[model samples]
Target chain A: MHSQTPTCGSIPPVPARAGIGGKPAHYAELLAARPPLAFVEVHPENYMGEGGPPHAYLEVIAEIYPLSFHGVGMSLGSSGPLDRGHLARWRKLIDRYEPALISEHIAWSRVGEVCLHDLLPLPYTDATLKLVCRHVEEMQLVLGRRILVENPSSYITPKDSAIPEADFMVEVATRTGCGLLLDINNVFVSATNNGFDPRAWLARISGHLVQEIHLAGHATIRSGELELRIDDHGSPVCDDVWDLYRETIARIGPRPTLIEWDTDVPELPVLLGEAARADAAAALSESPHAAVA
Target chain B: MLPLHEFQAAMASYLSSPPGPDVSHHLKSMMRPSLRSVERRLAVYKNNVYARLVDALRDSFPAVERLVGEDFFRYAAVQYVSITPPKSPTLLGYGKDFARFLENFRPRRIFPIFPMSPISSSVTSKPITRQTRFPSASSGASETATACCCIRLPVF
Candidate 1:
């Protein structure tokens, strides 16, 4: 096995400021403008190919800014064994880029032979917790790093779920010595849809364990009288999520935050504008009287 | 309660199957009580799974999606996804068999006139994004603390 820590002497640490999801649409402008940002996060699955424009673009981006490999296809919550080949490819990319941070969802995407290619929810139980923790430990052992596990946005909560989502995340982090990537929008989405308080969920989490935070836009899907917030990440962050984000910063202090615009990715300025808003929120939170407001 | 694997297995089956009373009944036992219709809530996952893969297919085969209108393409895609779900996490070549599936889905369509060679070339080459003018290389080195990170198992 390679050294537990890959040779990352050259990469800068991600600053505790706002960043945007790395998109191919904005590569030219990103390179041209060279916006004042902390880091850029990308899905490693997109760069798994051997030699392509994705690598070429990422190579240049990696050279300039700190990178966070936000993996979407790891399927960490699956009950079965982790896929070794996927792990190896991820290891290869991590070794090459030497990103500042890395993370994956608590949700699973693959089941048996079927790769659903979407993050699916998992029940929270003792047995399920053990399985996720084991998988997380194995992932850390293989990659030689303490990866952050993100909370999933829920549409359906399993009846067998015994542990609360926040406690489950804390337990996984506690047991595996990993960190948490708190997606604040997901907290709000799950809270609204599942009938819970987003703030209480945030308060339940161990703030120190949270290494990074994600802010994304969600869409509301209404069926008859019921309206459900879908974590679509295709628009600007709503005011409610932004309020929660501000509260989180005030409560836990600022972490390396991200503006995730995956589906309907806008121009670089729009994303940069959102990042600026995040920075503004963090700045406000740091004020001496921020607690009062 | 069902074992973890059994629950996930059932979830996969339920999500993949068509949304109907029978399918909703299968998942009703697993899901918690909600104020809204359980079927609508469950449909979110089904929509997410199908929509995500369909978007991936559109990314891979934009020409095909264009050749057959969005509605037709989506109609065909749902059928293909139902019969043959992706087996790998790497969606780069996930729809390798889509052209073949299209052949079977609508044999009478104008597939013959379509330039199969270029589309195949595009797939093998795999250039998903437009070419960007890369800036001149600037080498800058900075020092910071090192931290390792990991996540769940993944398949290529």
Candidate 2:
């Protein structure tokens, strides 16, 4: 039986600056450069397998930089139970690496047995709130640390949603004693697709609970006559999303922000360039003049 | 208020395929902006789900997809989804079955992706057969046991 006991000592926290999505292509470049990144957030599932280059590179990188274990398969918002095996696999990574932050989404991609990898939307209702809180509490208890729940970028708002998206996230954070991931691009994407003000979105959420920030790019697709924005993560962080990020940083103060470029990932330099821009944007919020009373 | 799980089930069904008349009749009424066609609104999620899943297949079976072209690949993806939906939460290893699916798929037989010499996904560099008959270049395959991206396929 695998020991659930936590033997690893405490690791340093992630710096409140900028980080890039830990892609394998850039692993060598990242190790050689060792740029000024607060931490590298990786999808734990990618490295869950046995000894391979993915783990080898991650091990070397972990030794130098703080690692954030961002999970995409916990299915925190599902009405069904969490996958025990998946959680066990994640625990192994966390125990080995002693990552600085652990996070999952506020969306449900599984129901009963069908497991869709897409980060599908969840209705903002008491039922969902209760389901998500139980899973979050259980995950935190098992993982032995509070996990942040991220807001999803949705294409369509489910009909008959009683709670607002931000309000639902705030409630999840409050009840589970968990933190928020606060993906700025999601706020912008969801707002643009569903028609809402993103600034007000930050106002509704409990910002203090926000532990990390995600800045990712999205793609637009045409569906019938309507134009829809999909969270494709295949391009650069748009100019408008960058504007929202600066505002979010100014309000939430500096946090460990990640530049997530999953598809058509350009060269390592391109991602580093994005990370550098994020640092500059967060630095502005850190400026003494930008502080709010 | 609709049952959350029931609503989610209907939504899931809709994402997998266009909603049947019976399924849409009740599910459509529960959504907001009733004035707008519910089908149209639901189309957004439908495209999102299919496009993402299709992309997963495209990534895994790029040769198969490239060989057959985009529309054909999408058709194969649709059939694959109907026959075998993903059982995992992450897309990392979602389309492991597609290679075999393509081989067995009647339409793909004409292209002969797998000519007499079965090119398996072996990780090592050992040649499958010392004596090999190189498949025609038009087949987009080679008889040599080449390890490409950990997938040992006979590629040209």
After superposition, the stretches of candidate 1 with alpha carbons farther than 4 Å from their true spots are A1-12, B18-24, B106-121, B127-156
Per-candidate TM equals: 0.88, 0.84
Off by over 4 Å in 2: A1-9, A291-293, B18-23, B34-41, B62-71, B91-93, B109-119, B122-156
**lDDT values, one for every candidate:** 0.76, 0.70
lDDT string, candidate 2, A163-239, tens digits: 99999998888777788999888898788778789888878876698899988887775646666566667678999
| Tens-digit lDDT track of model 2 for B1-156 | 787788778777766663232336776766665334456556555555555556556545556556668777777777787567667655545666666776677876666454444334331221111111212123122121110001111010
Candidate 2 has an lDDT of: 0.70
